[model samples]
Target: MLTDVRKTDRLNLMDQRGLRTSTWNVLTPNAPASKNLLSEELRKNKVSITGLTETRLTGCGEERIGNSDSLLWSGGSTRRNGVDLALNSLARKALLLHEAVSDRLMKARFGHKHGKMTVIVCYAPTSNSGDVTKEDFYSALSRCLATVLPP
Candidate 1:
C-alpha cells in the first residue's frame, strides 16, 4: 500500500493509517475508455477508495467495474455534473451504506473494526456559473450533511 495517499493539502487532516483514499477530477466517466483508465489507475495505486468528480453519467446507482471493484455514482438528467465513489474489494466488504445526494454530491459509509467512517464526495460549480447556482449547490450539500446521524 502507498504510505502517503493525501497528495492534496486539503486532505492532510484525514487519517493515514492503512486506509488509502484518493480524489480525482475524471472529466467524463461516461466513456468506456475513461472508466477503464480509472480502474487501471486504482489498481496500480492499490487504492482502497477513490472519489471522482465530473463523471457525466446519468442517474444514480452502483456498478461492478470488475471482480474486485465497485462504483457508486450520481448524476443529473442532463449528464453535466456527477460524483462517484469507487471501492476496492476490501473496502466494498466494509461498506455500510451509500447515498447519492445529487449530481454534485455523493456519500458512502464504511464500518471498520473500531468505528464507522463517512466519506462525502462533491463537485462545486465554477465561479463562472451564476451565484444562484452556487447557492443551490451549497444548500443541497447542507441538506445532505444534515441527514447524516452521528455514530
Candidate 2:
C-alpha cells in the first residue's frame, strides 16, 4: 500500500497517524459490480479514506457500504467529470462536513487531533482543454479554499 494519499498540490497540511488516505481516478463506478469491486479493494487495502475522480455519478449523495464504510459522491446531470470520497469506519468518525462543489470538485472536513483538516478532491481539465475551462476550475478551487475555517 502507498504511504500517503493527501492531494498535497491542492492543499498542504501536517500529517496525522492512522489515516491512510489515497486518491484514484476511476473511470466510473455506476455499475453495481464495479462498486462492489471498489468496496472490496478498499477493505483489502485497509484505506481509511479515498478520493475518487471521474466517478460520473449523477447528483450528490452518500452511500453506505456494508455496515461501516461510506461513500460521499458528487456529479452533474450528464455522465461526466465527477469526484467522491470513500471513508472507512475510522475516517467516518472524523468526518465533520462535506460538499459537492461541482462536477469536478468535492470537499470534506475531518476533525483530527490537531483540530480540523479540509480535503478538496478535484479533476482538473487536461492541458488540451480550453483556457476558460482551466481558469474556471482554478477559480472555483480558490473560492473553496478561501472558505476554510481558521485554525
Candidate 3:
C-alpha cells in the first residue's frame, strides 16, 4: 500500500480514512542506514514486494542496505547499479549470477522457478564521451539485441 514513494528516501502508506498506514525511511551512505527503519516501514505498510531504480551504485558488494524485515531483496547503489525483487519465498529460491563480458560491461541473470532472465548492465559511452558516432551506437545496440533476437 505505498501511497507515495519518492527519491529523497522516505516512503509513505495511507489508508482511505486519512489514517496512517505505514512509513518507510532509510538513509544511504555517510553511515549505515538503520535496519529498524525499513523493518518498521514494512510492518506498517504490509509491503509484500517492489523494486528500486536509479540506485546509482558503482560497484558490487554483499551488504544489507535496509533492515531485514523491510526488504526482501536489493540491488544497485549510488552509481548506475540497481536491484530487483522477490519476497520471502522468492528469496529462498533466488539465484543472482554475473557474467563479465568486459570491464565496462556485464550481465546479471536471475534464475527462478518461473524461468531464467538477464539484465545486461553496461557502461555504454555517452553522446559526448569522445568522437563516437551514431554508427557506433547502432552497432552496440545491434550486439545487445542479439540476446533477444533471432540469429
lDDT of each: 0.79, 0.80, 0.36
Best by TM-score: 2
- On residues 1-151, what C-alpha lDDT tens digit does candidate 1 reach at each position? 0011221112222245478899999887776566666777898998889999998888888888865688888888988998999988778777777878889999877766556677899999999999999999999999889977675
Q: What ranking emerges by lDDT with the best candidate at the front? A: 2, 1, 3
TM-score of 3: 0.36
Q: Candidate 3 — what's its lDDT?
A: 0.36
| lDDT by residue (tens digit), candidate 2, 1-151 | 0112333232223345455779999999887777768878998887878999999999888888755788888898899998999888767666767888999988888766566787889999999999999999999999889988874
Name the regions of candidate 3 deviating beyond 4 angstroms. 1-60, 69-93, 100-104, 132-151
Candidate 2: minimum summed lDDT over ten consecutive residues — where? Answer: 1-10
TM-score of each: 0.84, 0.85, 0.36
The number of clashing residue pairs in model 2 is: 0
User: What's model 1's TM-score?
Assistant: 0.84
| Number of the predicted model whose lDDT against the real structure is largest | 2
Error of 3 at 110 (Å): 1.5
CA deviation > 4 Å runs, candidate 1: 1-17
Return the clash pairs for model 1, or none: none
- Name the regions of candidate 2 deviating beyond 4 angstroms: 1-17
